[model samples]
Target: MNPFSYHKPTTINEAINLANLTSRFIAGGTNLVDLMKENVVRPKRLIDISGLPLQAIEATANGGLRIGALVSNSELAWHPLIEQGYPLLSQAILAGASAQLRNMATTGGNLLQRTRCQYFYDTGTPCNKREPGSGCPARTGLNRMHAILGASAACVATHPSDMCVALAALEAVIHVQGPRDERQIAFADFHRLPGDAPERDNHLSDDELVVAIELPPPDFAAHCSYLKVRDRASYAFALVSVAAGLKIKGGIIEDARLALGGVAHKPWREATAEQVLKGHAPSEALFTQAARVLLQGARPLSHNGFKVPLAQRAIVRALSEAAFGNTYAGATP
Candidate 1:
């Protein structure tokens, strides 16, 4: 790891003031610490925002939930409000890292976690995300974990956050605080696709800090599911995960929200596909059609073509689980 100065700020303003282009905030040190060790990210300064006051899970006045950035993943998953009102979020969080890592990973840190592409981590290799204009080896190398959607010629990396997939389906809003002022970013617009700029992940500025996450009123609490498929059963990143939310009435779908992970640069959500689910009765045929619509424009890589079909089936299964009132499922092959 690079030798860098460390600062512990007790206040949000202090943390914000300490932020700079060459500095990074460390709340849980779950992901950032690993990146530093791998030499994937070498910051000149480490700002310890763990001491800052940003750890709370409260209900908003508008009947939504406001989650402080520093709220631990385990805490958020098991929080009574989250478990009762947004079980999909809880499920997604639990499906992530191991129990110990979850205890250390924070909401903001999870949001800022880097991709798991091997080429991106191995400093000896060439990865566009690691160094722009440096050739993307994953595009033609062993790339079973690479992207199948929203990929570009410059990069084929996928976002590696299960919580983010659920957040996308929940339509959560990201709250950020920069040196200038605070702003709200819609979840759909927060994470960007890998177009020309593969280095940038989300819309967060260099000097901005994610203070909290805001969730709109819960609508699909009663019918929701988070399904993650991976090579191994435990402690593995997703291959093709789906977060499905459905609101059905009189055996007819009234509303639907579906977001995909492990298949794109961001949490992939096609509003048109979700619209296809509305007003239709939940069935195998309907779900299959919706999955087809969701994977319409998917362009798989050399070794990750399986992800396209896997994602489609996962979406159908996730929606069926949600509509049928099932909760969790195994990561079966």
Candidate 2:
């Protein structure tokens, strides 16, 4: 890895100052360090914000949960309130990385983690995202893990954050400390699409530090779930994943949210699909229609044509199990 200065700030002010001067922020250092070693990202300095008081999970004034950015994946997955109230988030975290990785992956780091695109990782190849106007090798190269939604001609890289997928489904808000002051951005707007600049990943300013994530409390009695399908079970990124929350009463759907991961440049919010479930009874037909709506605009590449059907099935399976507990999840949970 390229040599770089390291600083551990004792206060938020010092942290912000260091962040302003540095190209990188190191929280858990799980993804950052790996990229640094591979020469994919080489920051002149690494500002360690892990020491700051950003590691707390407390109840919001309105009865929701506020999760500090430095909180580890494992801590979040096993937090008493989260496990009981937001099973979808907990389940998504547990399904990601591994037990050891979860212990090291922080909420802020996880959300800001870079994509797993092979061409982007290996800067030797042509990638407009890495080197603008250079050209995209993935367009004609091996790209089984490319994105299906919100992609542009410049790039088609998937956003790889399992927890963020669940957070999107729950309509969580991201809280960050910026140069001006603290700011709260809706989860949907936090992550950006490739558009014309795939290089810019999020709305985070150079001096901003992600503070915490605020999740509105879900009724513990209501059903919710996250389903991830991969080439292998553990320690593998999702080929297609679905996060869903549902409320059903009197044999009619009261509310629902569904977000797709590993298939979109940003968190794929299926608002159209979710609307189909509201005020409707849970049935195979309803689930099928909703799933179809979600995958309507999927544009697949040469090798990844299977992702569309697979993602659609994943959404149907996740919603069906979440809205109505299934034998599979029951046998496991």
Candidate 3:
């Protein structure tokens, strides 16, 4: 790792004053530290924000929950309010990493986590995301884990956060504070697509710091599920995951929210698919149709054609579980 100066800031103002283009804010150091070791990111200064007053999980004025940026994944997942009101978020966080990592990973850090694309990680390889204009080897190289949605010629990487997928489905809001002002960004708009400039991951400005995540009311708590399929049963990144939240009444879907992970540059919100399921009765056929609608625009790479079908099945199973309140017995690859 490269030599860098470190600063521990107790106040957000102190942290903001210390942040710059060459400075990075560290929370749990789960992702940033790994990238630094890989030489993918080398900051001149590390601003430790863990001591800042951003470690609370409290109720919002609108009967929702506001999770501080520093709240650990394990804490957020097991908190009574989260477990009772937003089980999908809890399940998604638990599906990610291991117990030890979750104990250290923070909510904001998870949202800002970089893609796990092999090309981006290997400094020896040419990757547009790692060094813009160098070219993306994964575009035509080994790309089983590459993206199928919202990808460009410059990059085919997929976002790797299972928690963000659930947040997308829940329609959460992201609060950010910058050197100039504070702003609230819709969760869907927080992460950006890998367009020409694949180097940039999200809409966060260079000087902005995540403050908190504000979740809307827990309407789908009773009928929400997060299903992650991976190479292994545990402690693995998702090959394809589905976060499904449905409000079913008298055998008909009243409202629905669906988001996909491991297939896109950001959390792939299936708004059209949700519309297709809103007024329909839950069935395998209906679920299949919704899945098809969700993956209609998918353009899979050579090795990752399997992700399309895998994501489709996972989506169906997740929706089935959410709508009927029964576990699906199918196996995942």
Candidate 4:
């Protein structure tokens, strides 16, 4: 890692004051430290915000849950409230990285985790995300892990967060504090698509610090599933993943939530797809129709074209599992 000045702030205001365009905040250094070592990211200053009082997991007045930004993935996944109410989120968090890495990965840091690929990390190759205007080698190279939707010519890399996918389906709200004022951002508006600006990942400003993630309420606690498909069983980034939740009453779907990961620049969600399932009886054919609506307009890369169909089948499988409350996920050959 490059030489950088470090500052440990005990308060949130002090930590925000220490932040700037060239500075980066470090809580759980699981993702940031690796980027620094690979020379993919170099900050002039490192602001340590781990000591701040942002570690609480409390209940909101609206019967939802308020998860602190500094709460570790392991802690959040295993928390009684989370496991009992938002089991989809707990499953998604537990599906990421490893137990040791999850212990060091915070909720805020997970939201800000960068997209990864061979070209994005190797400084020797040209990657638009690493350096804007540079050509993206993944577009024509080994891109089995590249994006299939919301991908621009400038970048085909996909966000690698399993937690973010569940957050998208849960429709969580992110609260952030900036130099000027504090504001709340909807989960859908937080992560941005490539859209010629591959360098910018999220809507969070450089000086802003994410305070907490507010989940509205638990509705699909009994009917939810998190499915991750990867090269191996454990510690592997997803090739395609699905987070599905449904509220069924009297054999009819009342409400539905579906979000896809490892297939787009951000956690992919389409309201129309969810709408297709609502008010309909849960069935295999209905789930397949919903999957088709979700995967509409998906444009695949050179080597990752299989992701399109794989995501479709995975969506169908996830929705079926959610409706039936089963544990079976995607079946890969």
Candidate 5:
């Protein structure tokens, strides 16, 4: 790792003031530290924000939940409020990294985690995300874990956060503090699609820091599921995953929120599929149709084309389990 100066700031103002073009804020250092060790990200100054007052999980007046940026993944997953009110979020968190890593990964850090694209991690490879104007080797190389939706010619990387997938389904709001002022970014708009500039991951400015995340009122706690499929059962990145939450009334779907991970640069919210299942009865046929609608415009890469069908089946299985409030027979498969 490159030599760097470290600054531990106790206040948000101090953190923001210390941030510069060559500085990066470290909350849990689970992801940033790995990238730094890999030489993917080289920072001259490391601003440690763990000393700031951003570790609370409180209930909002509007029956929502406000989660501080420093809340650890393990804490958030097992918190009473989260487990009782937002089971999907809890499940999604538990579906991610190992227990040791989760204990050190923070909410804000997870949101800012980089993609797990092999080409991007290997500095010797030609990855546009790592070096702009360099060719994308994943475009024609071994790329089974690449994206199947919202990918561009420059990048085919997939976002690796399972928590963000559930957050996208819940429509959480991202609270950011920058040098200018504070602002709220809708979860849908927080992460950006890989357009021309694939190097930039999210919409956060260079100097901005994520303070907290505000979740909307809980509505699908009783009928929500997070299903992650991969090569092995435990501690593996998702090949295709689904975060499904549905509100069913008298055998008909009242409301639905669906999002897909491991498929794009950001969480792929299935708004079209949700619309199709809004007033329909929950059944295998209906769920299959909804999955079909979700994957309508998916443009898979050379080796990742199987993701189209795999993601569709995962969506169907997740919706089925959420609707019936029971695990499906082959949900994991």
Candidate 6:
């Protein structure tokens, strides 16, 4: 580990001031510490923003929620207000990390967590995301976890957060404080594409402090859910996960939204699929048809053809369960 200085600031202004001086933003110390240990991220100073008054979950006048960045994953998952109003988010959070991690991981850190790319973690490899213009090793190397949608030859990493997938489906807003002032970013546009610059992750500037995450009220999030498929059942990232929210009226989908994880560079939303299901009766046939449309442009790698079918089936199964109340049958082949 490298020698580093730590600073705990009590105010947002001071936090941003300290944040601008270094690349470190410490909240729960769960993700950053791990990366720092691996030498993936080395900063001269670590700014501890946990001391600030950023841990509040208050209902907005708009009847939505303003979740403080410092709020632990456990606190958000078990909050009575969140459970009663946004069960999907609660369920997603519970399925993530572990009991101890959920206790220490905070809202800001979770969204900003780095990708699980093996090459990115290894300092010996040439990953453009780890070092600019170094080139992407996963581009031709063992790339089963590489992305399909919104991916460039430069980078193909999939974002790795189930809760953020749900947030993307729900159209949550990200709030941040920079050296200048505060700003709110829409969920869809928060994480940038690797068009050319794979190094820069989110829309966040280098000197910004993520103050909070605001979810625009989901009147029906109580009826939503997140489903993850991994090689293992526990403590593994998603092979293909679907975070879905739907409202059925008279056994037909009235309003539907779906975001997919482990399939694309970003939290891939099945908008074409949702279009197929909306105003239609809840049924397996309809789900499969929409799933087909969503997976139309999937370009799978040699060893990852399974993900194409796996991601497609995940959509079908999640839609059926969320809309028609059906369980997923495992891949037959």
lDDT of 2 by residue, 1-333 (tens): 888888888888788877754469898889998889889887988888889898999999999999999999999999999988898888889888989999999998999998889998896788777788887777678879888777788898998889989899989999999767999999999999988888888999999989999998675236787888888777888888888888888988988899999998878996888999999998878988999999888888888889998887777788788878861211111
Query: Distance from true position, residue 134, model 2, in Å?
Result: 1.6
Two-way lDDT contest, 2 vs 6, winner: 2
In model 2, the clashing pairs are none
Residues 218-254 of candidate 1 have per-residue lDDT tens digits of 9999999999999987888999999999998999999
Candidate 4 lDDT, 68-154, residue by residue in tens: 999999999999999899999999988889999999999999999998888999999998899999899899899999998999989
Q: What lDDT score is found at residue 209 in candidate 4?
A: 99
Tens-digit per-residue lDDT, 222-323, candidate 6: 346678888766677777888878888877788888888887778887577779878988777887888788778887765567888887778777776776
Give the whole-model CA lDDT for all candidates, comma-separated: 0.92, 0.85, 0.91, 0.92, 0.91, 0.82
Off by over 4 Å in 4: 328-333
In model 1, what is the error at residue 182, expressed in angstroms?
0.8
Report how far off residue 169 is in candidate 5 (Å).
0.4
For model 3, residues 1-333, the per-residue Cα lDDT tens digits are 899999998889889989999999999999999999999999999999998889999998999999999999999999999989999998899889989999999999999999999889999999999899999888788999889988999999999998999999999999999988889999999998988999999999888999999999899988888998888877888889899999888889999999999899999986788999988888999999999999999999889999998899899899989987874322349
Local lDDT at 143 for model 1: 86
Give the clash count for each candidate: 0, 0, 0, 0, 0, 0
TM-score per model over all chains: 0.99, 0.96, 0.98, 0.98, 0.98, 0.95
Model 5 compared with the native: what TM-score?
0.98
Could you tell me which residue pairs clash in candidate 1?
none
Which lDDT value does model 1 have at 1? Answer: 84
**lDDT value for model 5:** 0.91
Model 6 clash pairs are none
TM-score of 3: 0.98
Task: Give Cα distance to truth, residue 38, candidate 4, Å.
Answer: 0.6
lDDT per residue (tens digit) for residues 107-217 in model 5: 999999999998998998888888999988898899899998999999999999999999999999999999989999999999999898999999998889999999999
